[model samples]
Target: MARRGHHVGVNDTDPPLPAGTPLPPDELGHRLTEVFDLVGPLYRRALRKVEQGEAVEGASVGVRSVLDLLCRKGDLTVPQLSRIQALSRQFVQRMVNDAAAHGWVEVLPNPAHQRSSLIRITEEGRTLIATVLDREHSLNREVGGDLTDAEVRACVRVLREMLRTFDHVDVDD
Candidate 1:
């Protein structure tokens, strides 16, 4: 059996290892594996929620944005909704169609325009968002029970900053 010798004791009195101690890249890879093992399942479970119909807020950001705009702004035409949601006309149309099927939104005649139509949220759609928000908030509270609201906000800010990477920026060696 191979004897392992990397067990550094957790005491401050012990002198630090010499600068020549080589760190195998495999050890760094193992650390990354452990981190992904811990975090990957969280994202997978969230996906599973979508598969199980628990993610009624819609599957894409485009869809959710359209609903949010409709719910917040009352009613709007296709072009109006598309512009407000910053989505392409085609994408907005697709979302509106799916939403219509889910009873989340409906199209009504636009008196202001001869050919265009108005899109508005249905009662069920409003209820669905309220339910989704309540469930999301409850889950957040349950998972982060030990964290204060300020800590949560700070974490969000830090995470957003970390994610604000630019594709145009090049790392030069």
Candidate 2:
């Protein structure tokens, strides 16, 4: 899906849109939605390719990131994870539940707060996450090898700025 479809002569030759004439608010929002719609399948396909020989189940980029965080940071509450991910607490909980069902993580009693429980990664989770990380690193290297470091850094900087303001966007609903 991210295969950078050939626009024939337009790939690198097309001129940038003129002076903010590309997308107005509504159009930008719609294009952003289209980006996600296009990216999800492509992203998943890449992950699938990475896990091709392995028997990894239910591995998505988001799910793998959750596991990676748990692996690196010990345990975290759902809200903590949600905040870190910039996703809804409910959505993160659903992911946690799914991982728990697969024995990749477990919900434990939290002395810090009775209402919030800590989720810890299991040994199985670590093993699977190890494989995921290996493939992820390899994929990143392969994909990023084509781009200059400056290009990658610019991409990261732009996305980070976008993320910082993501929740501030006004919704018409």
Candidate 3:
């Protein structure tokens, strides 16, 4: 039995809208539909490509996220990776395991702690990240080429600020 809030796949049914309502630009419905439109197909295509092994080094987004973190921050222990990524320690460890197995990362002994290991990107990992990053840059340019670099940076800053605000918002009973 699936746990509560653990359902997978799409919900095909649509929700009813208010009668004669002019939907607010930032309404949940508008945002959801926009997310579905942009992310749904991208998710499907990325999944298909991964399944076909077109992108081999970073097979999963979670793994790629970790690699990107390591690329920017250098070596990190599992606990550090978990904290930085806001992921479960087990989850980060799994990515680390996969990365280690594929020669994408190297696990070095942590001098401070005998039981813990620090992971650093290998040369192969850096090479793969360079390729992935180049592709990501091209995709970003295709999507946001109209925006000036400064405008794009400003938009990113604003979006991140919004995210931070939402993170602090408490649920109302």
Candidate 4:
């Protein structure tokens, strides 16, 4: 039996919104704002933990994000990575530059794109990311105790769907 406030795959405070139902702009804004308010702090805290032992050089969240990606996704051109991460090219470029300065990544000439360079992770970066992730497991266990694995998986799926829908919806129109 699920505990109160521990329901899987649905909000506990309210009934589930109907499929294909569009919320009023104000209501949608309010819910999204609430989510950001709650989720943003968690992200910041985790990022801080990941950076704790990192060298002061290139230790900004932006640089860490680039290093994390390069370490996980193998080599990628700047634009390709920017698109995949849903970040602007300029912002990613700056992060990439910082990572390069710290020897966490290497920028090699891209054969297909003369201008965009391929960014690859260095051994040092991999080791550092590994260390961060090793710690993250404990953090995950600490926070995830409130939810069952099924509930967590369902929540992640719903969040991904919401992000996909947001990508298609144009708020201004």
Candidate 5:
């Protein structure tokens, strides 16, 4: 059973507003803060869930992220991955190192940059990520809210806007 204040899915805290309701700046800020509050817990919980899975038991979230990026974008330098993922170069390098140790990725000489090597996902890495993603997709299919595409799209828009608002802020590690 879910605990109090730990609702599994969406909670209707505030009533729906009219289609063209004019939101004051303070009200909008408050609403966005509520969204942010939920996002932090949701992300941590999701990471924990992913880590707990047997298929990906040994893969840390950071390592999985690096592998997924390489699988999707082909070989890329550590600096490029860092910039794309908005992570520090040192952190990304550590993740790459971990993946390489696990035989999930390989570092190759980059013709463009003699110093920064290109990171490529191995066949083993592709298989692992595919399994992880397939499991996630199966879990997502359980989200039975009868949600519409338009609603999901609107949610994506709001999240993207929230991200853009903080794009200028720097919290590099």
Candidate 6:
């Protein structure tokens, strides 16, 4: 049985390792699996929170993601956004359509690809995404963990390494 706040198959009863404890390469995979287990639920719950906050604006998590990407990366094609987000091109296209309907984003001509138009976040989109991100940041600041910058960086490094390991995996598959 799983303990509260823990996923099944991960033994949460075990005392946590001391800070900076050296983990053997083989054991590291098992520990990282626990991290992955927690990440799924964390992501879902976080998505729900964001969706709830965005209810007033009628933006789903997917649309927010598309808008945020366009805001950060300037303009990009649906295929480019799909690849960057590891989502299907069709799904991304739907998101772009939703954003366009809200006047948050615009479809511009892509000189590089006649078939694929570039998606740009309009001024309205930029403002909405900025507000969303600001709210998220404020919520993030309320996280109870007294985590230091080094600890957060280490967490990011671990997540990045995990992402890189699966970078070659086809999302469509």
Off by over 4 Å in 1: 1-61, 139-173
Better of 2 and 6 by TM-score: 6
**lDDT score for residue 163 of model 1:** 38
lDDT of 1 by residue, 1-173 (tens): 22223223222244445665753555434433444565589767864654454445554545566777888889988878766544567778898888888899999998999788999899988887666656656766668458877877966764454335332343221
Query: Which regions in candidate 5 have their CA more than 4 angstroms from the true location?
Result: 1-22, 54-57
| Overall lDDT per candidate, in order of appearance | 0.65, 0.73, 0.69, 0.72, 0.82, 0.86
Instruction: Give Cα distance to truth, residue 131, candidate 2, Å.
Output: 0.4
Query: Model 4: per-residue lDDT, tens digit, 99-161?
Result: 788788899998988988899999988876676666667777777457887888867976686
Please provide, for model 5 over 1-173, each residue's C-alpha lDDT reduced to its tens digit, 9 standing for 90 to 100.
43223334223554556887755665676667778899999889888878877454477888888988998999999888887777888898999999999999999999988998989999999998888888878988988889999989988988999888777765464
Indicate the residue-level lDDT of 171 in model 3.
33
Off by over 4 Å in 3: 1-58, 166-173
List the candidate numbers ranked by TM-score, top first. Answer: 6, 5, 4, 2, 3, 1
* Clash count, one per candidate: 0, 0, 0, 0, 0, 0
Judged by lDDT against the true structure, how good is candidate 6? Answer: 0.86
Cα deviation at 80, candidate 5, in Å, is 2.4
- What are the models' TM-scores? 0.48, 0.63, 0.62, 0.71, 0.82, 0.86
Deviation (Å) of 170 in candidate 5: 3.0
Q: Candidate 5 — which pairs collide? A: none
- TM-score of candidate 5 on Cα atoms, chains taken together: 0.82
Between 4 and 6, whose TM-score is larger? 6
Best by TM-score: 6
The sequence of per-residue lDDT tens digits that candidate 3 reaches over residues 21-114 is: 6445445444445545766797787656544443555456666767778899999899888876667788889998988887889999999888
